[model samples]
Target: MSIENDLTEFISRDVVPEGGVTETELLISSGKVDSLGLLQILGFIEQQYGVTLLTSGSPKDFESVQTLASAIRKARGESA
Candidate 1:
Protein backbone atom coordinates (compact mmCIF):
# COMPACT_ATOMS: atom_id res chain seq x y z
CA MET A 1 0.00 0.00 0.00
CA SER A 2 0.94 3.63 -0.39
CA ILE A 3 2.01 5.80 2.51
CA GLU A 4 -1.31 7.55 2.61
CA ASN A 5 -3.22 4.29 2.82
CA ASP A 6 -0.86 2.92 5.44
CA LEU A 7 -1.20 6.11 7.46
CA THR A 8 -4.97 6.08 7.14
CA GLU A 9 -5.14 2.52 8.41
CA PHE A 10 -2.76 3.28 11.24
CA ILE A 11 -4.77 6.26 12.33
CA SER A 12 -8.01 4.37 12.14
CA ARG A 13 -6.72 1.51 14.23
CA ASP A 14 -4.48 3.33 16.67
CA VAL A 15 -5.77 6.86 16.97
CA VAL A 16 -9.41 7.17 16.04
CA PRO A 17 -11.71 4.91 17.99
CA GLU A 18 -15.14 6.48 17.64
CA GLY A 19 -14.82 8.78 14.68
CA GLY A 20 -12.83 8.78 11.51
CA VAL A 21 -9.37 10.27 11.46
CA THR A 22 -9.15 13.71 9.99
CA GLU A 23 -5.94 14.79 8.41
CA THR A 24 -6.06 18.08 10.30
CA GLU A 25 -6.90 16.56 13.66
CA LEU A 26 -4.71 17.22 16.69
CA LEU A 27 -3.71 13.71 17.60
CA ILE A 28 -2.11 14.30 20.96
CA SER A 29 -3.94 17.27 22.44
CA SER A 30 -7.28 15.96 21.23
CA GLY A 31 -6.62 12.81 23.28
CA LYS A 32 -6.91 10.66 20.19
CA VAL A 33 -3.38 9.47 20.65
CA ASP A 34 -1.15 9.26 23.69
CA SER A 35 2.58 8.79 24.22
CA LEU A 36 2.29 5.03 24.08
CA GLY A 37 0.33 5.32 20.86
CA LEU A 38 3.07 7.46 19.43
CA LEU A 39 5.64 4.84 20.37
CA GLN A 40 3.55 2.14 18.79
CA ILE A 41 3.24 4.24 15.66
CA LEU A 42 6.99 4.70 15.59
CA GLY A 43 7.45 0.98 15.86
CA PHE A 44 4.92 0.36 13.11
CA ILE A 45 6.67 2.76 10.81
CA GLU A 46 10.02 1.15 11.53
CA GLN A 47 8.79 -2.36 10.94
CA GLN A 48 6.59 -1.61 7.96
CA TYR A 49 8.56 1.01 6.13
CA GLY A 50 12.09 0.58 7.39
CA VAL A 51 11.95 3.90 9.15
CA THR A 52 13.61 4.76 12.40
CA LEU A 53 12.14 7.60 14.44
CA LEU A 54 14.57 9.26 16.79
CA THR A 55 13.11 12.23 18.56
CA SER A 56 15.19 14.57 20.65
CA GLY A 57 12.53 16.66 22.38
CA SER A 58 9.81 17.47 19.91
CA PRO A 59 6.65 15.62 20.68
CA LYS A 60 5.02 17.69 17.97
CA ASP A 61 6.68 15.52 15.37
CA PHE A 62 4.12 12.85 15.95
CA GLU A 63 1.15 15.11 16.35
CA SER A 64 -0.61 14.58 13.02
CA VAL A 65 -0.91 12.24 10.08
CA GLN A 66 0.87 14.68 7.81
CA THR A 67 3.75 15.08 10.23
CA LEU A 68 4.08 11.33 10.72
CA ALA A 69 4.05 10.75 6.98
CA SER A 70 6.74 13.37 6.50
CA ALA A 71 8.89 11.83 9.23
CA ILE A 72 8.46 8.36 7.80
CA ARG A 73 9.41 9.53 4.32
CA LYS A 74 12.46 11.28 5.68
CA ALA A 75 13.56 8.22 7.63
CA ARG A 76 13.19 6.08 4.52
CA GLY A 77 15.47 8.43 2.59
CA GLU A 78 12.57 9.72 0.53
CA SER A 79 11.38 13.27 0.05
CA ALA A 80 8.09 14.15 1.63
Candidate 2:
Protein backbone atom coordinates (compact mmCIF):
# COMPACT_ATOMS: atom_id res chain seq x y z
CA MET A 1 0.00 0.00 0.00
CA SER A 2 1.05 3.59 -0.49
CA ILE A 3 2.22 5.61 2.49
CA GLU A 4 -0.92 7.69 2.52
CA ASN A 5 -3.12 4.62 2.31
CA ASP A 6 -1.21 2.89 5.08
CA LEU A 7 -1.41 5.97 7.23
CA THR A 8 -5.11 6.34 6.58
CA GLU A 9 -5.62 2.76 7.60
CA PHE A 10 -3.61 3.24 10.75
CA ILE A 11 -5.48 6.35 11.72
CA SER A 12 -8.79 4.70 11.07
CA ARG A 13 -7.97 1.69 13.19
CA ASP A 14 -5.90 3.33 15.88
CA VAL A 15 -6.72 7.00 16.21
CA VAL A 16 -10.39 7.60 15.54
CA PRO A 17 -12.89 5.44 17.39
CA GLU A 18 -16.15 6.30 15.70
CA GLY A 19 -15.80 8.64 12.77
CA GLY A 20 -12.66 8.91 10.62
CA VAL A 21 -9.90 11.23 9.60
CA THR A 22 -9.76 13.34 6.47
CA GLU A 23 -6.53 14.29 4.79
CA THR A 24 -6.68 17.88 5.94
CA GLU A 25 -8.29 17.45 9.33
CA LEU A 26 -6.56 18.82 12.39
CA LEU A 27 -5.85 15.49 14.07
CA ILE A 28 -4.24 16.85 17.22
CA SER A 29 -6.82 19.54 17.85
CA SER A 30 -9.83 17.41 16.90
CA GLY A 31 -9.50 15.21 20.02
CA LYS A 32 -9.06 12.22 17.74
CA VAL A 33 -5.35 11.94 18.32
CA ASP A 34 -3.28 12.45 21.43
CA SER A 35 0.38 12.57 22.45
CA LEU A 36 0.72 8.81 22.92
CA GLY A 37 -0.93 8.35 19.58
CA LEU A 38 1.59 10.72 18.10
CA LEU A 39 4.39 8.49 19.37
CA GLN A 40 2.74 5.49 17.79
CA ILE A 41 2.38 7.46 14.58
CA LEU A 42 6.02 8.43 14.65
CA GLY A 43 6.95 4.82 15.17
CA PHE A 44 4.67 3.79 12.34
CA ILE A 45 6.26 6.36 10.06
CA GLU A 46 9.74 5.24 10.95
CA GLN A 47 8.96 1.58 10.36
CA GLN A 48 6.84 2.08 7.29
CA TYR A 49 9.00 4.66 5.56
CA GLY A 50 12.32 3.48 6.99
CA VAL A 51 13.38 6.82 8.39
CA THR A 52 13.82 8.33 11.78
CA LEU A 53 11.61 11.28 12.55
CA LEU A 54 13.33 14.24 14.14
CA THR A 55 12.31 14.64 17.77
CA SER A 56 13.11 18.34 17.53
CA GLY A 57 10.46 18.97 14.91
CA SER A 58 7.08 20.46 15.56
CA PRO A 59 3.88 18.54 16.31
CA LYS A 60 2.58 19.82 13.01
CA ASP A 61 4.61 17.13 11.36
CA PHE A 62 2.08 14.56 12.54
CA GLU A 63 -0.99 16.71 12.09
CA SER A 64 -2.69 14.76 9.31
CA VAL A 65 -2.28 12.14 6.64
CA GLN A 66 -1.31 14.71 4.03
CA THR A 67 1.22 16.44 6.25
CA LEU A 68 2.61 13.15 7.52
CA ALA A 69 3.07 11.96 3.96
CA SER A 70 4.98 15.11 3.14
CA ALA A 71 7.13 14.66 6.24
CA ILE A 72 7.88 11.09 5.23
CA ARG A 73 8.77 12.22 1.73
CA LYS A 74 11.05 14.94 3.06
CA ALA A 75 12.69 12.49 5.46
CA ARG A 76 13.38 10.17 2.55
CA GLY A 77 15.16 13.06 0.84
CA GLU A 78 12.42 13.44 -1.72
CA SER A 79 10.97 16.81 -2.64
CA ALA A 80 8.06 17.58 -0.36
Candidate 3:
Protein backbone atom coordinates (compact mmCIF):
# COMPACT_ATOMS: atom_id res chain seq x y z
CA MET A 1 0.00 0.00 0.00
CA SER A 2 1.02 3.58 -0.64
CA ILE A 3 1.77 6.01 2.13
CA GLU A 4 -1.55 7.74 1.76
CA ASN A 5 -3.48 4.46 1.80
CA ASP A 6 -1.45 3.10 4.66
CA LEU A 7 -2.03 6.19 6.71
CA THR A 8 -5.73 6.16 5.89
CA GLU A 9 -6.09 2.57 7.02
CA PHE A 10 -4.00 3.02 10.14
CA ILE A 11 -5.82 6.17 11.09
CA SER A 12 -9.18 4.56 10.43
CA ARG A 13 -8.43 1.38 12.34
CA ASP A 14 -6.21 2.70 15.11
CA VAL A 15 -7.19 6.36 15.29
CA VAL A 16 -10.88 6.60 14.57
CA PRO A 17 -12.27 3.03 14.48
CA GLU A 18 -15.86 4.26 14.36
CA GLY A 19 -17.11 5.97 11.24
CA GLY A 20 -13.59 5.79 9.91
CA VAL A 21 -12.02 8.33 7.50
CA THR A 22 -11.18 8.94 3.90
CA GLU A 23 -7.96 10.23 2.45
CA THR A 24 -9.29 13.76 2.13
CA GLU A 25 -11.29 13.66 5.35
CA LEU A 26 -10.80 16.17 8.13
CA LEU A 27 -8.52 14.71 10.80
CA ILE A 28 -7.52 16.94 13.66
CA SER A 29 -10.40 19.34 13.38
CA SER A 30 -12.95 16.51 13.27
CA GLY A 31 -12.56 16.19 17.06
CA LYS A 32 -12.30 12.41 16.79
CA VAL A 33 -8.64 12.30 17.64
CA ASP A 34 -7.38 13.34 21.03
CA SER A 35 -3.85 13.69 22.41
CA LEU A 36 -3.50 9.92 22.83
CA GLY A 37 -4.69 9.39 19.27
CA LEU A 38 -2.06 11.85 18.10
CA LEU A 39 0.61 9.82 19.90
CA GLN A 40 -0.63 6.65 18.21
CA ILE A 41 -0.37 8.35 14.83
CA LEU A 42 3.18 9.47 15.54
CA GLY A 43 4.11 5.97 16.60
CA PHE A 44 2.58 4.50 13.46
CA ILE A 45 4.54 6.93 11.34
CA GLU A 46 7.84 6.05 12.99
CA GLN A 47 7.19 2.32 12.95
CA GLN A 48 5.91 2.13 9.40
CA TYR A 49 8.16 4.65 7.67
CA GLY A 50 11.20 4.48 9.92
CA VAL A 51 10.89 8.21 10.40
CA THR A 52 10.38 10.19 13.59
CA LEU A 53 7.59 12.73 13.32
CA LEU A 54 6.27 15.46 15.58
CA THR A 55 7.91 17.75 18.09
CA SER A 56 6.53 21.25 18.21
CA GLY A 57 3.90 21.82 15.57
CA SER A 58 0.27 22.69 15.21
CA PRO A 59 -2.10 19.75 15.10
CA LYS A 60 -4.25 21.60 12.61
CA ASP A 61 -1.40 21.19 10.16
CA PHE A 62 -2.06 17.45 10.25
CA GLU A 63 -5.04 17.90 7.96
CA SER A 64 -5.52 14.58 6.20
CA VAL A 65 -3.96 11.60 4.45
CA GLN A 66 -2.66 13.63 1.52
CA THR A 67 -1.03 16.17 3.82
CA LEU A 68 0.58 13.53 6.03
CA ALA A 69 1.82 11.63 2.98
CA SER A 70 3.50 14.74 1.68
CA ALA A 71 5.18 15.31 5.03
CA ILE A 72 6.47 11.74 5.07
CA ARG A 73 7.75 12.08 1.53
CA LYS A 74 9.49 15.31 2.38
CA ALA A 75 11.04 13.79 5.49
CA ARG A 76 12.42 10.89 3.43
CA GLY A 77 13.83 13.42 0.95
CA GLU A 78 11.63 12.02 -1.79
CA SER A 79 10.05 14.28 -4.37
CA ALA A 80 6.32 14.75 -4.35
Q: For every model shown, what is its TM-score relative to the native structure?
A: 0.77, 0.83, 0.88
Instruction: Please state the error at residue 43 of candidate 3 in Å.
Output: 0.1
Q: Where is the poorest 10-residue window by lDDT in model 3?
A: 52-61
Candidate 3 lDDT tens digits, 1-80: 79999998998898899988898887878887788998899899889988776863345448887888877887788985
Task: Kindly indicate the candidate among 1 and 3 with the higher lDDT.
Answer: 3
Q: Residue 54 of model 2: what lDDT?
A: 60
Clash list (residue pairs), candidate 3 = none
1-80 per-residue lDDT for model 1 (tens digits)? 77767877887877566675766677888888777776777788778877777653256667777777877777667997
The prediction achieving the highest TM-score against the true structure is 3
Candidate 2 deviant stretches above 4 angstroms? 54-56
Each model's lDDT comes to 0.73, 0.79, 0.82
lDDT of 2 by residue, 1-80 (tens): 77788888888788675787777788887788888887787788778778677663566776788888888888788998
Question: For model 3, how big is the CA root-mean-square deviation?
Answer: 1.7
Following a full C-alpha superposition, what root-mean-square deviation does model 1 have from the true structure? 2.2
- Best-to-worst TM-score order: 3, 2, 1
